[model samples]
Target chain A: MDNFSFQNPTKLIFGEGQIAKIANEIPKDKKVLVIYGGGSIKRNGVYEQISAALEGHQWSEFSGIEPNPSFHTALKAVEQIKAEGVEYLLAVGGGSVADATKFIAAAACFDGDPWSILSEGARIRAALPLAVVLTLPATGSESNPNGVMTNYETQEKLAFYGRQLFPKFAVLDPTLTYSLPAKQVANGIVDAYVHTVEQYLTYPVGADLQDRFAEGILRTLVDNGPKALSEPKNYTVRANVMLSATMALNGLIGSGVPQDWATHFIGHELTALHGLDHGQTLAVILPAVMAEKREQKHEKLLQYAKEVWNISSGTESDRIDRAIDETRAFFESLGIATRLSDYGVTEQDIPAMIAALSEHKMTALGEHGDITPEVSAAILKRCL
Target chain B: MDNFSFQNPTKLIFGEGQIAKIANEIPKDKKVLVIYGGGSIKRNGVYEQISAALEGHQWSEFSGIEPNPSFHTALKAVEQIKAEGVEYLLAVGGGSVADATKFIAAAACFDGDPWSILSEGARIRAALPLAVVLTLPATGSESNPNGVMTNYETQEKLAFYGRQLFPKFAVLDPTLTYSLPAKQVANGIVDAYVHTVEQYLTYPVGADLQDRFAEGILRTLVDNGPKALSEPKNYTVRANVMLSATMALNGLIGSGVPQDWATHFIGHELTALHGLDHGQTLAVILPAVMAEKREQKHEKLLQYAKEVWNISSGTESDRIDRAIDETRAFFESLGIATRLSDYGVTEQDIPAMIAALSEHKMTALGEHGDITPEVSAAILKRCL
Candidate 1:
């Protein structure tokens, strides 16, 4: 195990009727700005819960935060924060809304142009206190300090993180997710699964607890993701998936370990250039990354094959192949097609992806920084 | 899956040589009190690390906190805090020092007699801020708000908890345990194992991730505990066990599950009466609790049998029995005897233990409040 420091201070208010508890979490004195994506919370009854919870506090609303959480849309919310004197932020939708809220929180308090926070890696001195009413379980944004946003002008997706961005509290009422469309539910599952494996699947670090935790999350997602779609209102299934997603990227499993995020960075480029859904991009890219990096990740792949997929009866090469195939099959079973051609990406599109990787200085990726632009292009060709 | 609100705010500064970072976690303005047990830290060079970390801070020392930390000893520290106007506390030893510091932190701010804080469950409105430099990893007091303190005058051991008691931060350097005696290391392993099972080994609520996490902690301890005894300076083994011990009782596994602390409650009586170490009492009592409550915990015991002990391919009853026996053997392998008689307790001592449980109002224990005094007596008889 490697040396690490870990702390996540998000108070997770989970299970049924937890939305109401946010009333006690956010102070009555703060003027709140409730942020949401495309008014889904309004249709799903989450808006009412937020309204009721914030009844005692002075508050306003910001709707139309999009998936991928565009940098321009978040800048508008930051402007609104300054205009309305918003002291606290309440994100009321899924990862997109929460991600936007994180950016808006920091951008509102930032001294200069906020885009530089993402593009130039500007230091974040402060941020508005933020909380979340998590209606979606993907991205694990509710409990983590990470946020990814797209700059429509530059057509680039980038992540920014700081200690100040951790949410003060997160309301995760899995019941709130009952009305989600099946495609979105599948996307959530695939996103969480890839999140877990990205931190895992890199190399062995002898971090036993972290490895087991990563495996536990993967196993939970595999078992609960399908049930969540087939029986949308099954509280047990929904709760398990919701909690698993939060735990997947909440700094627990990834701590004191080397993490390979080459797939995510490549997937982000796909999302930026082609407008693929984040989860869809991950499904298209991850199996290819697994195959291309097999030699580097050989030992961990065998362990993953055994512990997660229960495939122990094969030559080492056969087991690795079976694990990757099982992973792609799992995503396909969730109605997510794994092949890039299945989504109409071709040899023609590969060059743009490679160029995007180079432009963003993502030429060297993966845990060992060995996934150069050429290697990423080869992985993309495998996806083809 | 139960409705639950969970938060643990203790910043875990983990890894080797992370002690110096505490200088940043603590405010330089506060008058600090460094608390520790009977100078194990002094002999182990942990004291030098802590002293070096607090070099610029105004700090004083309070020593002689014993195992099963006495309330009287903590009270003396509270008085010292009052006299010196100490505004912050830094517990520098293991669970005992941390537990004692918790009581002292709360008692110093209480309006009246501090004993009521333990005896009468006084409402704690405030507490002095505290942090920890954890030289011992057994009790998980570093990352959790819960603490156990013994009222030596009353011959009673009890637990107390409050939101205010959560440590501000914890410095977990696994290397700190390198010089510990084999008995203490073995005791730490048993303590952490029992902690994991107390939260688990109850009825399942479809809490797959929780179950997996509990099993992960148990597996890590089982794999790493003996190695810790033999290869005391092996960083990976020490780190895994240290991290597992902290994760065992940090309120994560027990958050949404039914927890059977009956073993712990029963163990406390044995300790309060016969003066067994906390870990020894757990080793002596847990298998008996499993035997006594086998019917109620049937499903989970089977799961535990297969997952942690890998005892499949037997009748369910056979599996449960084998699992219980394996648990006892594991403890014995650690040089901690698994029977009450092994500790010199006889049938004559059972009544005193039962009387102590009754005196502490622990007549009904375990997850479902089903372990009555009679059931506890049965468990004690099984132990004998």
Candidate 2:
């Protein structure tokens, strides 16, 4: 195992009726700004529960943070936060809302242009204390320091992180997710699954606990993701999926290990260019990346094939092939199509995706930094 | 799954050469108290490294904290802290030193007789901030708030806990354990193993993520514990076991689950009465507990048998029996005898053991409080 230091201090308030915890968690005197996406919380009764919980708090609201959490929308919240003297922010929708809240929290307190926090890498000295009522469980933005946002003007999707971005507390009541559309539920599952594999399927480091933890997350996703889709309101299924999603990217399995994020780096380009849903692009790109990066990730693929898929009694190449096929099949099992053509992405779109890698200086991707722009183009062609 | 709220704010600084982190983690303006065990640290060069790291810090030293830390010894340290005006403490040895430091930190700031903090359940409102440079990986006290201490005067061992008792930071360098005696290493392995099973081997709660994480920890222990024993200085093996031990009781697995700590509770009595090591008592008690409570833990025992021990393809009763036997054999393989007679305890000890449980009001134990004193007697009898 590689040498590492790990600490995540997010106070995860999980389970039914946990939203009321916000009443005590946020100090009574702090002025709060509640952030949400597209007003889904209004239709789903989430907003009402949060309002009931925060009955007497001095608070304001901002809505319509889109999926992919555009920077423009978050900048508006930053301005509102400054204008209203918001001391604390509560994100009450999906990862997009929570992701946007992270940016808004940093931007509101930033010294200069807010976009520099994402584009020019301004150092963040402080941020608005943030909490979340996570109505959705994807992205793990509720518990981590990383947030991804899109610059609609530049057609760029970018991510920023700071130590201050972790939520002061997050309430993950799986019951809050009961009213989500099936497509979004499926998107959450795939999003979480790919997030785990991004940190996992790289190479062997003899990090036994980290490997087992990553496998455990993957296995939980495989076993429980379908249950979540089939029985959306069942607490066990939803709780398992919700907790699994959080654990996937909450820095538990990723610590002390080499991580390959070529898939996500590529997937983000697809999302930026084609306007594909975040998870939709992951389904389209991951299998091709896995196939293209096989030699670098050989031992892990064999282990994943055996432990996760139970397919070891074959030639090594046969097992690798089977693992990649099974991965694509797992995506399809979730009603997620894995081929680029299935999403109306084509051969002509390949050059733009490869060019985006260079434009973002993400050419040297993967655990070994071997996924160059040329290799990325080949992987995308495999998606054809 | 059960409803749960979870948070652990202990910053864990892990890996080789991480002892230097204390230079930065502890503030410059505070008087510090350094705590440790019988001077194996002095012999192993750990003390030297710590001393080398604390060159300019205003710190006082307290030595001679015994294993299964004593409250009497801890009280002396508490007094030293008061006299020296120590604002911060750094525990520099194994679990005993770390555990003693937790009690000292709590007792120093308690506004009453310190024993009241333990025996009379004084609610703690504050504590001295503590940090750890862990030379032992066994009890997980470095990363958690719980600690066990013995009262040598009364021949009673007990535990105390508070949120305030958690260390501000813990430094775990596997290289520090390189010179440990093999028996101590074996004891550490068994201690960590039983700690995990105490949380895991119970009725299922449909907590998929929790279940997977528990399984992952158990699997890592089984896979790496022997490597740590056979090759004492192997960094990967040492790192894996060290990390697995920390993760075992860091509240990840036990959350949202019906945990059976009957093994630890029973083992504590045996340790208190017979003066056996914590891990030795666990090895002696756990398999017997598994056999006696096989009915309540039937499904989980079968699952443990299948997953951890790989014992399937047999009758249900046969599988359960084989699993228990395998567990005992594993302890014996580590040169730990798993029966009372092997350690020279007799039937006379059983009455004293039952009295201990009753005296402590631990008459009802296990997940559902089904392990009455009578059940405890039955489990102990199986050890005979």
Candidate 3:
């Protein structure tokens, strides 16, 4: 296995009525900014629970952090935080709000233009301590030190990572997910499944234990995800999905191994240009990326075929084909479209996406670092 | 799943030559106390590597922490640490040294008699920061907050847990295990396997994902352990075992689940009384414990049978029996004796061991709060 240093200090408070724990987790003396998206929390009673939990704490609310968590919208929250001298941030909605709050937390402490942090991918030195009341189980932004931010003007989305911004505490109540729309639930499952695959389907670096753990999370998602969609009120299914999403990308599976995040990097362009949901874009791109990178990731693909998809008894090429097909099938099973055309994207948008990828001098994508811009275009063409 | 809060903050630095990186992990300004067992490290070049890494650091060495880590021996190290005003501790050997250093770190800052902290099971309020260069893969003391300390005077061993005493860092190099004896390697595998089983093999409790993770760790240990023993220098096998041991008991598998550590608690008594190795005692006790608690833990036993041993085509009773038998056989395959008679323990020791367990009043020994003292004694009798 490769050399690695790992430390995640996020304290996860999980189960029913955990939202009431907010008052104890955060200091009452600090000025807190509770961030959210739209007014879903109000209709779902999460807002009332959070407010009752806040009690005498010095806090205010910042609403309307959009679905994709755009830099343009997050900067407004940062401005309010700076103006109010907020010392802590509590994100109380879905992954988008949590992801935006992460940017707001960093931007509140950053000296330069906040947009530069995303565009230039600058190292973050310090940020206001952030906590979350996670009502959504996608993105894993609650426990991990990663957040994807979009620039609306440039029509671009990018990810930023720093050790300073991991949540101090996250309260996950699976029952809070009972009120979520079915589409959002399906999107969360697909998002979490792809997260596990992105970490696991790459070449194995003799990290057998980590590989098994990655596969375990993958299998759990596939087996339990359909049940979660049908029975939204099933506490066990929601709890399993919540835990699986947290474990999927919380730096546990990626330890001591090379990671191929090219699918995510490519999918961001689809979200940026076509305005597709983040999880839906991944459903469109992952299978095509796997098919294109099959030669380099052949052995791991075969293993994934047998272990995750149960596609044994085939030649290597046939196994890779079946594995990619199984992946697309799994996403489709979640009611997510696996083709760009299925989502109403035309062939006209493909050239612009390809140009954006090539403009970045995209030459390395998979585990072997060999996915070029032409190969990316080929993958996208297959998706079309 | 049950309500749970989980957090582990130990920074794991894993790979070859990671010991050299210890200089940067610890604070140079703090007065450090280096603790270890016998002089095996000195003969194996680990001591030299640590010495070189200690350049320009204020540090002192306290050697001779024995196996099982007695309170009598740990008191001496505590005294020296207090005299030197040590601000941090560095444990450089196996789990015994690391476990001993945890007590030393707590006891140095503790008021009143240090043994009171163990005997009274009082909450530890503060402790000096501790780090480790783990040369053993058996007990997961390097990454967890729990430690077992023996009272040599009473022939008693007890476990104490405190949140304040987790290690600040742990350096794990699988290459460090290459020179270990064959018996130590076998013991390490059994120790890790039992750790996983203790957390698993309980009632399902809606923790399907945790069950899968626990089973994955068990499968990895069974698959890679023999390869590690036969080819001692095989990096992949050693790395897999090291990572498996860490994942097995680092609170990852136990979260949101009912854990039955009755076998570990009982195994400690056999070790303290008979001078048998901790892992060997566990091998002897676990199968008998399974047999004794089969009725209460029937559902989980069937799950374990189907998942780990793959005995699906049998009656429930037959499957439980086969699973228990297979567990004993796996331990024997590691060259461990799975019966008390194989270790030369006679019938006279059984009543005294039962008395010790009764004194502790461990009423809730198994998953369903079963495994009374009488049941524990019956399990011991079966082992004989």
Candidate 4:
């Protein structure tokens, strides 16, 4: 295992009726800015919970943080913070709202243009305290310090992370998710599954516990993700999916291990250029990446097959192939089409994706840094 | 799953040469107390690493914290802290040292007799900041807020926990374990294993992820613990064991799930009465607890048998019995005998052990609160 340092300070208030805990989590003295997306919280009763929780606090609302949240909208939230002196941020939706809130929190405290934090890797020196009433369980952004935001003008979707942005608290009431559409639920499962594989499926470094943890998350998603959609109100299934997503990318499994994020980087470009939902992009890209990088990730692929998918009675190569097949099928089973063409992107669209990868300087990616633009292009063509 | 709030804020500086990170973890201006047990760190190069890390800061040392740490010894450290106006604590040894440091950190600032914190459940209002340079991989006190401190005067070993006592950070350099005796290595393994089962092996709450995580820890320990003793210097083996031990009782698996610490509570009495090491007591009693409570824990024991022990090909009762037997064998394979007689406590000693549990009001012991004094006595007779 490689040397690593880890600290996650976000307090998770989870289960039924947990949204009320947000009242105590955020200080009443602070001027709070509650952020959400597309008014889903209003329809789902989450807005009422947040309103009830903030009864005694001075607060205002910032709506319309979109999926694959853009800096264009978040910058407006930062402007609102600057004008009103908002001291705390309450993100009341899923990953996008939480991502935007984190960005707004940092951008509000940043001296320079906030886009540079993502585009130029500028350090985050300070950030407003952020908390989340997580109505969606994908992205794991509610607890993790990382966030991905888009620059609409540049057509760039990028990630920025720092310790300062870790949420002060996250109220994860899975019961709040009962009102979510089946497509959204499926997307969450697929998103969390891909997150686990990105941290895993690279190679073994004798990090057994991490491998097991990664497998556990994958298995939980595989077993409970489908049930969450079919029986949306089953608290156990929803709780499993919710917790799996949070654990998938909370930096625990990824720590002390080599990680392959080529799929995510490529998926981000798909989101940026072609406007695919984040989970859909991952679904379309991951299996191809797995097949393209099979030799490099041979051993871990076999392990993933056996431990996660329970496919052990085959040759090593056969097992890996089956694992990739099962992975693609798993996403497909969630009603997501895995091929690029299935999403209306043909072979001709591949060059544009490769060009975007080049523009972003994501020529070399993955754990071994060998997934050059050519390799990525071949992987993308496989998705076609 | 049940409603739960969880947060662990301890920064982990892990792997080789990470001990130097402590220089930045603790403040430079604070007067620090470095605590350890029996000077093992002095021989293990941990002392040198700690001293080098503490060079820029003013620090003093307190040694002789025994195997099962006592409030008596911890009070002396607290007295020194009060006299010297120590503001920060650096625990430089194993769990005992870390546990003692936590107790001392809380007790130094505590009002009235500190024993009330354990006996009377006095609230902790303040505590000195604490950090750990963990030289051993058991008990998980380095990162967890909980600490068990024995009151030698009363022959009572009790646990105290609060948010205030969590270590600010922990430096876990697995290389430090290379010099440990084989007995200590085995003890660490057994301690971690029992910790996992205590949180697990209760009736399932459909907390599948927690069960998977618990199983992962158990499997990692079963797979790597013996190798740690055999190949003492293997970094991978040592790292896996160290990380597994820390993850075992760090509150992640126990959160939102019912935990049965009947083994631990019973094991504490054996330690307080018969003078067995904490790990040794656990090794001797856990299998017996499994057998005694097999009916109540029937479902989880079946899951444990299948997932952790891979004993799926049997009747439910047979699988559970095999699992218990395998657990006992696993502990014995570590060279820690799994019977009270192995520690020279014969059948005659059962009454005294039961009396210790009675005195502590451990009449209702497990997750179901059904491990009454009678059940405990039955469990003890089986241990004999």
Q: To one decimal, what is the Cα RMSD in angstroms of model 3 from the true structure?
A: 1.8
Lowest summed-lDDT stretch of 10 residues in model 2 chain B? B326-335
What DockQ does each prediction reach against the true complex? 0.89, 0.88, 0.86, 0.92
TM-score, per-candidate, Cα-based: 0.98, 0.98, 0.97, 0.98
Q: What is the lDDT of residue A189 in candidate 4?
A: 89
* Candidate fnat values, all: 0.87, 0.90, 0.89, 0.90
What docking tier does model 1 reach? high
Residue B17, model 3: Cα distance from true site in angstroms: 0.9
Please identify which of the two predictions, 1 or 4, would achieve the higher lDDT against the true structure.
1
Q: Which candidate is the best by DockQ?
A: 4
Q: Please say which candidate is ahead in DockQ: 2 or 4.
A: 4
Interface RMSD of 4: 0.5
Span of 10 residues, lowest total lDDT, candidate 3 chain A: A359-368
Q: lDDT per residue, candidate 3, B140-234, as tens digits?
A: 88999988898878866777888887899999999998999989989989999999999988777878789889988988888888888889999
lDDT at B130 for candidate 2? 96
Each prediction's whole-model lDDT (CA) = 0.90, 0.88, 0.87, 0.90
- Please say which candidate is ahead in lDDT: 1 or 2: 1
